[model samples]
Target: MYWSLITGMALAGAVTALPRLDSRQGNGQVKYAGVNIAGFDFGCATNGNCNITAAYPPLQSLGGPDGAGQMQHFARDDGMNMLGGTLDQTNTGKYDQLVQACLATGAYCVIDIHNYARWDNQIIGQGGPSNEQFVSLWTQLASKYASQQKIVFGIMNEPHDVPDINKWADTVQAVVTAIRGVAKSQMILIPGNDWTSAQQFPTKSGPALLKVKNPDGSTDGLIFDVHKYLDSDNSGTHTECVTDNISSAFSPLADWLRANKRQAINSETGGGNTASCQKYLCQQIQFLNQNSDVYLGYIGWSAGAFDPRTYELSEVPSRNGNSWTDSSLVKACLARKAS
Candidate 1:
């Protein structure tokens, strides 16, 4: 039933371009809008195509003892897994490499700090270092890349299974404060709790806005990072998922941003690219081009992943020969001009 709805919506908006927001007419505040593509999660790094096998094959299969052995091989070959490495925010070398790659492609790079510290992997918010750890990480990241016009700092990925919104807000505040200390001008992307749901932003109880005292005492560059997926519970989606959501699905977050006087961007959205999905994905590009105000920018789910079923774009296939590139997806993402 839902699929039919999505199909209808997709067909209805096929002829017309997505809506647009007049950014230039505003208060000279150029919104930092772009895609949120993850290249590294802890220690796993994806090459430009976002495939794990292209860069590190051992960690590709997270199996049992063999998986452990493969992980060791991966660590030896590709440095260390991000979870085990020193949480040194100042280490910008790896980040610099990722940023350079994205910029070279003429796309915005969104770095993800996939932190989870709890008994169940389900506890997305349970585990992770203290507030100080995030502070250090952001301080280093912001200080190093703060000046770059294209770089946007996504504080954290998804926070799930965590009940306390206040605590999450506090943690986000600490990181925001720390990042502000160094990257005053750079835009800070903040996502809501429970995996950054559009519905949660309005109903969730937390510090609604992250306030920072700039030297000039004016609110400068702060952005709301929102991740949306049409799948069940909004877990995540690929290009097709975004396409289906464009017609009737885009209104919730769009309305929120308008009411809050805030700018919103999909820091992450992409999983399993198929033919229909590819067309759906291209529709999002058209959507972004038309709607510049509510939809600031976006980032694809990954630059690398073990499962080919979940990839939106990749340089090589995890299962076998070189699939190399999804020309359709790439073409769609790069087609729109930064408005």
Candidate 2:
């Protein structure tokens, strides 16, 4: 669900306050629908360093010609309700415009920390950055967006290869405490290790991560963040898809979620624009919509700063004059609601 070269992400900080908002409180067929708006998180890598020099220019810089219009098209035109953006620790303030744009479009904003459980290639807490430092990063951010009801804190993106999964959970526990200390009602999405792989979640990381609780000792606004792709090896790089991942991934994960009385979100899942992707991706999302009881919703891999024609799994809409045309995959699947 991510490029190896430009990985890792988090969101900018804002002090503005608004009313509390929680969109996934009731039983339904997935409460939120959205796409990821990349670019602000362009220069990050699994090593935990974000080179601002390698990042893409701000979408706002493109002005109405297409920058802000991209988000508007997805929200107003595509009926998407949530918008995900990357936030890197080195450039937390870089995403303010992206966040503001998402808010203006009347969509929920998921500020994701795109780091893969490490900083400078050292595993977080286990040996790399101290847990306090991680908590501190969240604390400052939580305080800044405490009043922004539409803000959703994506604790970390795709954690993997941690030596002690239990310790990682403890680190997440601390981050949750720090965030809840400042923002009480905003939703927080927590990702498990192994790239938050849905296939490995129920067994590998779920047990420990499930132990993580809100300060109230409840799992109210906290949701599990999972990712699944349809490529042969599930790396998300190939242009063709080999499976829908229902039996191999989502189905088993769904069963576990229901059995545990918890819910999860498919934070990232997509395939290239092809007939194979069309058939399988549609089925995958349909499964999510059907099992909305334990699933919040799904967000496609991306659609920001990436060109529609050039990007492999492009969900970015193309513009012709004043009209916009969504990618074939989006039109046929991601943007389509349950029947």
Candidate 3:
């Protein structure tokens, strides 16, 4: 009976595999696991194809009244307290709500852990917690949402200040193993080092598949994650620069995947919501659409950030005023269907 139930589910899941958006055949439409994917970020909190940006829920400040330093850096009592409370409160109901919201918006909910204590220093050459801590966190998160179908897990936001590829591979394996234990079907995204830069994807000598030993001494289910930023040097605002950078970095990885028969996804990209970077963002979407095989999908850098002072996306202040959502870049991304 147990085997029969498992078999039934496997068959059902197979039947609903993510669909491909084929532009050559008809109007651009997105298919996910054999079905059309409604593409929108749940975090955006916008309804339908609306143009208004909604404010993020008021999260208690990790930093004191001033909001001076990085909230994820200090690990202060208040911050940790808030973190625990938010996770406890949201992980269950909030996750479900977010997932439903995205589905309603015609998109899948790509849940990002966002911060892993390593990001603070990596942006400036500072180091973060030991790899063990990261593994433990992954294990816990994987276990929490092991059974959800709509959730795609992004392992880490950006791995910066970490140059050791071997260490990165090991960490990836650990997290994948831990998550697979509970949620075998949930797509796991493994980013390359240095903010998921395509430039850093293992070209000549790096672990191809992150593997871990199962109880029967076998391994399965891993997906490579790559992020493409048009300007690696972080200079210039030209759309061509973005497209060129994406073409240069992504072409190699795309080729590698085809040659090796591996799956990969462009999990995240998009700079701040500024007029200067709008064209760059659209060009990126167009490029990804052109090469969906190499670039499976994308999740923009953010719908919103906890820290309004530094990571603000909408033009209006998150605390006081309403923000506009229908930016040119975001519209391009949402309107983009698999092509």
lDDT of each: 0.43, 0.77, 0.40
Cα lDDT of model 1 by residue, 1-339, tens digit: 000000000000010122244433233212332222222342321111122232221122322112222222222322211111113343344334444544444333444454421222333233445677657766776776777655556665555556666667666777777777776656555766666654566556223544433345444556676665644445553333434466544555555556655566665554445566456655654565455666655544433323445443431112213222233443344222311
Worst 10 residues of 2 by lDDT: 10-19
lDDT of 3: 0.40
Best by TM-score: 2
**Tens digit of lDDT per residue, candidate 3, span 1-339?**
000000000000110143343323212321221111111121321111221122222222311121111112111211110110013544335334434333333233454544422433342112445566666666766676676565566665445445565666666676776777777766666766655566566572235333433334433334565655554353222232334455566657656665654556555455545554566666655555566544555444322223334433321112222222233444444333221
Q: So what's the TM-score on candidate 1?
A: 0.63
lDDT, candidate 2, 1-339, per-residue tens = 575323222121121232133333334346677778777667778777767676663375643224467777777777777777733653556556667777888778888777788878998898898999888888988887888888888888888888899999999999999999999988888889899999999999999998899888988878899999999989888779999999998999988887788888888888998999999998998888887777778888778777676778877778787777888888888774321
Question: For model 2, what is the alpha-carbon lDDT of residue 34?
Answer: 77
Query: Which candidate should be chosen as best, given lDDT against the real structure?
Result: 2
In terms of lDDT, the poorest run of 10 residues in model 1 is 4-13
How many collisions per candidate? 18, 9, 13
Tell me the spans in candidate 1 whose CA falls farther than 4 Å from its real position.
1-39, 42-92, 103-107, 116-128, 205-207, 210-218, 237-243, 246-249, 304-325, 332-334, 337-339
